[model samples]
Target chain A: MLSEFDLIAQYFTRPPRANGQVALGVGDDCALLTPTAGMQLAISSDMLVSGRHFFADVDPYTLGHKSLAVNLSDLAAMGARPLGFTLALALPEARAEWLAPFAKGLLALADLHHCELIGGDTTKGPLNICITIFGETAPGQALRRDAAKIGDDIWVSGTLGDARLALAGYRLNACKNDPDEPLGGQINLDASNHALAAARMHQPTPRVALGLALRGIAHAAIDISDGLIGDLGHILQRSGVGAKLSVDDLPLGAVLAQQPQTIQRHFALAGGDDYELCFTAAAAQREAVLTAAQNASTKVTRIGSIVADPGIAFVAADGTALDLQLSSFDHFRTT
Target chain B: MLSEFDLIAQYFTRPPRANGQVALGVGDDCALLTPTAGMQLAISSDMLVSGRHFFADVDPYTLGHKSLAVNLSDLAAMGARPLGFTLALALPEARAEWLAPFAKGLLALADLHHCELIGGDTTKGPLNICITIFGETAPGQALRRDAAKIGDDIWVSGTLGDARLALAGYRLNACKNDPDEPLGGQINLDASNHALAAARMHQPTPRVALGLALRGIAHAAIDISDGLIGDLGHILQRSGVGAKLSVDDLPLGAVLAQQPQTIQRHFALAGGDDYELCFTAAAAQREAVLTAAQNASTKVTRIGSIVADPGIAFVAADGTALDLQLSSFDHFRTT
Candidate 1:
């Protein structure tokens, strides 16, 4: 059995990066980070528990990727450049096979974004992964959720709901093997579509570049972690404004678009784990928004407009009001 | 049965302090913090598991206090002033009875230190608390473990072994109730002594002020979390220097002072959960060290001196060698 320090040294510790932001890294009582002059620090934390956030037998490699990816998504929402992150993990045991690939997947993403893993703690317990990530943004330049203007156009980056479709497929498969397992509805997908949805669910691409690109163009933003309707509701509630969302105009994931209209609408509107960016911008900046998306090489869709009213008014392509009851993912309220 | 958002709002969320360091607090995708000019941010993370770190039925208030206390102790070791923190908690269920006191204990300590709760994530799982604390210190001023030098006097703050004694008492009680329970040896403590030890174990006072005061005085410092022997080994390993420790000179907790010599030696040397600061400084700065301790209103005791060798040499009051086999706490190797 590996000691806690040995496990951390083998799987997590890395030499300090040349960036010099981290004055002292791992192996210290506390990691020291030199903040960029005149920049504000954007911080966010997310926790993932086995059997709640992810499957007990989910690939450890993907689990590692998703754990850090979800937190990076928050930094992306704030239009902040990645700085570093601290991971606090509770594992059942120190198995080399599980740790090697898990670290590989986690560091692969960290390396891609140049976000160094500065420090963390490891302990023996039920499986849990918590990451607190830091990023840097110019003061007052962060795209806040409460900054959405009344005349702003709502834009979503990439696609939504494929992760939810993947989850439904997993649940459906489990229900087939164990009849006692609750199946919300009869949901099925072909093998290829299942793979596509699963990939989105496991390996989310945080729109960091798009966020940086839209720093000046975007008025307000939030990463679509808890579906479009639910996440956008945060912006509306905080901004003290309402929105008119075109349900038919919602960008569907490639795999999600193949499903029936009812499934597409339900999953796209109410699905969790999308991890795409849902942001608002003035109508005049529509061209700027498109240019920013082009620069970031990410897709953008104008699916709605911020309104002066108090609650969201979902509408069809023909502008007919549609009533859709959707509640965001709540850890306690949900399974 | 509160929703996750409602639970956070009710117990965790607080209005931003007038200090104005937190540009944005809870209810956002990410919290924005404005760093002080020329100050480096000190970050540390700690995770406490239910069964391993604390008793399953322990008081929620103390658990809350200790959860943040342990993290703050890391900052204290780094000589960093409290700034802010992010909490990521996993609970088995959302029960108001548990959360109310837990948050109270946590916030009380946080308020004392002026560490604002900026942002966090809440989820449902086996109870766990992971707090990533932030503090600030001027560049190159942090008392790192690698800065210890030969001929430096090793000093420890407050008391040692009381927490360990308290733990032994609990384990002994458990062993009495269940004979199958492992008891290292027959041990007993009076009720009042147990309470003192228990307080030390549960609500440790992180020496933040002393750490700040010792900025240029202490050469290298580390908080004694994993017992003095294990924690001091880190300094020796990192600094490439050893020490001559006077085991008899270790300041014992008031309750621990009444224990037998063997028990005192064992717990004082290898007992974990002691949040006192163990630091090293040049012999010439003894008066300066005392002044710093006085300024912080914390007691300090010199019990050892750094040596040229690569490992610690335990000694008696008469300077005679004392051979004692002691191993530091390793999360995976211990219990």
Candidate 2:
């Protein structure tokens, strides 16, 4: 068996980047990072465990990508530019086949965002991946959940529910393949649609560029990790406001568009792991919002408007209030 | 079953600290932290998994303390002042009995250090705790592992090896009480002494004050988590220097003082989980080093001298060299 130090050196250690914010990288008691003057550090942590967060036989490369991508999504929600991150991994064994591609997928995203992997810890245990990411933004420029104002237009970037759609497919396929597997409600998806949705689930694109572009424009923002209704509720609760959402206006994922209207509404409204940004902006900034989306090459859809009342009212296309029973993904309750 | 949000609000959430460094805490996409002007941020992450880092049936309170304590020790090694920390926890279930005391112990330490609990993620899985701690220090003032110089006097703060002794006691006691348990080498330890050693293992002091006091005085330093010989070897390898260690001069813990000579030497030399400061300073600065230790109320012991050679030489009190076979704890190779 490879020693821990050797394993880290072989898989995780990288040459220090020139002109990087990190003064010292790995092989130290603590990594030293120089925050830019007049900037605030934005920090977030996310942990993914096998069989709970992902399937036991998930691809190591995609698992690594999703791990850091989810954390980077948090930074994107805050309109913070990626700086550095630390990974704490627990693995049952140090396998060369698994580690090689895992590091490759993780570092590829880190490199694209100019984010450095400064330091981390690896130990022997059941597989778990936890990343704490750091980013920097000017003071008062970060889009916070509490900053939403009544009458602001609520917009969402890209599509939602593809990841959740993929999850349903996986559950259904597992039940069909093995009768002993627990049944999750029935769902039908073609192989091509399943692959597209799975890609969205495994390789989420963090809207860092869009987040940076929306700085000073977005009144409030949050990444859609726990479904739209539940995540948007966070903004509503924190800002002491409500929302008038057009249920028919939600941008459906290409794969979900093929499903029935009921499935489309449910998946798009309450599906988790979307990793898309739901942001609020001034009603007059509609043109600017479109321009920003164009500049980042990401699609944007106006789905609703913030209201002074305290609860969300779902409206159908013909202006009738829709009564739906839906809940966001809760790790403890749902799992 | 409690939801993830309710669980966080019930046990982990605390009121914002007065005049704290954190601009935003929990309930946000990311926590915002303001770094002191002209200070560099120091970051470190540590992950503890059940059955690997701690006993499966370990007390939740002590486990909580140890989880954060080890991460804080890394900040102490860098001579950094505590700022804030992000926790990522995984639990099999939400049991109030376990979470209550666990959060109490964790937050108690954070309050003592004035380190706010900013933001984190809670999920359902096999129990694991990962904390990424941040601290601040003036540039060029951090005690780095690569600063050790030839001819510098090697010093250590606090006692060593008690944690390893306690571990041996636990192993021996388990074997004696349960025939099905794996047999570890037999060791006799009275209950009183065992308790003393166990406390050292559970609740370790981070030596932050001593690290601050020795900011410019010590040329290089590292916290000894993996035993003296191995950790000191890191400084030597980093600085391209070696050391001449006096085997008899090592400071033994109170409980280890009663052990046989061979046991004392082995435990002090290669036993892991010690969390003490092993540092090196100029030969002429011995008095200054002593004063710094005195001010911090921590004991300082000089046990060796840096050498121009490329490997450590063990010297006995009688001025003769002795060869010993020893290795530091490796997470993958060890249990």
Candidate 3:
């Protein structure tokens, strides 16, 4: 029976750790942060609801990590450095067990990026976690959605589809939708691969460094949260351009690569929640792009090229248009 | 059925109207804001959930206005001017009839404060609204809770207790807990008074102008979402000081004034959700405080003085200590 104030003081309240940026922190009417001179502040918010966004028994540690990670990804997409974040949490009850690990996981990531937990509100209700993150970028250096050129090359960081594959496998195995299938109707994945996929799904490493490096190197950037094709469509819509993506060049880890060709392509292109950086850069900046990737110690693969035509085309190895109609997961459509 | 994207685009999206400060607005991974040089960004978040914060059938319009108003009140307490905000919404379903009015109320308030709707995530779930608002104040100009000094005069803007009175009357009437009461076994209030109290509960005017004018004039400040004594306890705790409050001097509008003396004092002292600005200033600055209130066109009343003692004493008009155990609403305790 912890009061909301006690709950906040115990689990959420922390000393102001983001020095230089945070002027005032928690236990105030409003937290204050001073933006660096010549820098623009980038802000975004995301909410995760139980049952809809995560399972009731999902690991609180992973849940906490995912909550802030998604927000940091937004800053990453904008090529902004993480500054601080405020969390608004609603809980059915204040269980110390869940909160301890949850706070640990959340703060670990925050500490890693120097994104202090500045201020937040906690209330008793159905479980919901909303985080609003702030970041900063120099006046004109932010990677924007509308800045892509027609002839720019489209690139994706790290691998894609593993998280979605993990989700699909877990759903197939746990729900046993295909009752006639063998092995308890479960799509059994190798233990290591399953773990990797699950880790990707649960604990996405935001591409903060890669994004900072790509600030001037990339023109338009977006984080791959709604799968590659759909998120790329956002850039296309904003920049008023088209893209030609080669299925052959789509980045995939060994686990995802071992899947059936259709499954691999589907998951790689339309499976959401990868949380990787996708960007468009000038073809002439190929060397610079490589240098930036090397500087970040992250893998960057060119997967497509932007075109003047105003529609996306998925191409095969022979340059023929793929006839497959794969669409990303839309929350309303899925429901 | 509306997908999350469509819901956001139709109900939440708008052309970037917060021009000069916003570098990028909606339709991006993150909204970018350029704070004025030598200014500090003030940030605060608030969450309102159905059943917990409001009735399920509460007018979507008032809910929208309130959802943002409460957050704005936090900024107002800090003497911060509204800049922009990000909304994270969870809806049980996408009902246009409900959403239309909700968005209208929300955007109207945003327009009034020039608080741009910058970026947010919309999801399908239990109805909840969380808004994180951003504002700015110049260096050393923002009002703070810990800045109160012993001997500083305590002042409250506008009236108090109407919202709490409204809640109490509604609860008492609907529940009929006291069968001994008259008027169909329920306490009765006149129509006009009830309407005034209800409006106070529903749409609190955040004292933004008074707060802006209080910069350098007020030593410490807080907006009374919680009751006077409880919220003022925050300033006491932070400032390491206590107060001697004159219950007689507590400001009350006609509706609250008509209540029984005990009930009036209880609600005015410890009943929450008033949203009026309670500030502290040096006794010598009385004239300046009056000037600030005059400039903002808001009423201000001095009710107490901060003392070096570590506990509050509510005194009677005859200088006798009032031994009333009035505590503010603690959500967990209330539940």
Candidate 3, which segments miss by more than 4 Å at Cα? A1-5, A178-192, A330-335, B1-5, B178-187, B190-192, B330-335
Of candidate 1 chain A, the 10-residue stretch with the lowest lDDT total is A326-335
Interface RMSD of each: 1.9, 1.9, 2.0
Give candidate 2 regions above 4 Å deviation: A1-6, A176-186, A330-335, B1-6, B176-186, B330-335
Chain B TM, every candidate: 0.95, 0.94, 0.94
DockQ, 0 to 1 scale, candidate 3? 0.66
Model 2 chain B worst lDDT run, 10 consecutive residues = B178-187
Instruction: Give the range of the ten consecutive residues with the poorest summed lDDT in model 3 chain B.
Output: B178-187
lDDT of each: 0.88, 0.87, 0.85
lDDT of 1 by residue, B222-326 (tens): 999888988899999999999999999999988888877877887888888989999999999999999999999999999999999988899999989999866
Q: Residue B176 of candidate 3: its Cα lDDT?
A: 66
- TM-score ranking from best candidate downward: 1, 2, 3
Q: Which pairs clash in the backbone of model 3?
A: none
What lDDT is reached at residue B98 by model 3?
A: 91
Judging by lDDT, tell me the better candidate of 1 and 3. Answer: 1
Q: How many clashes in each candidate? A: 0, 0, 0
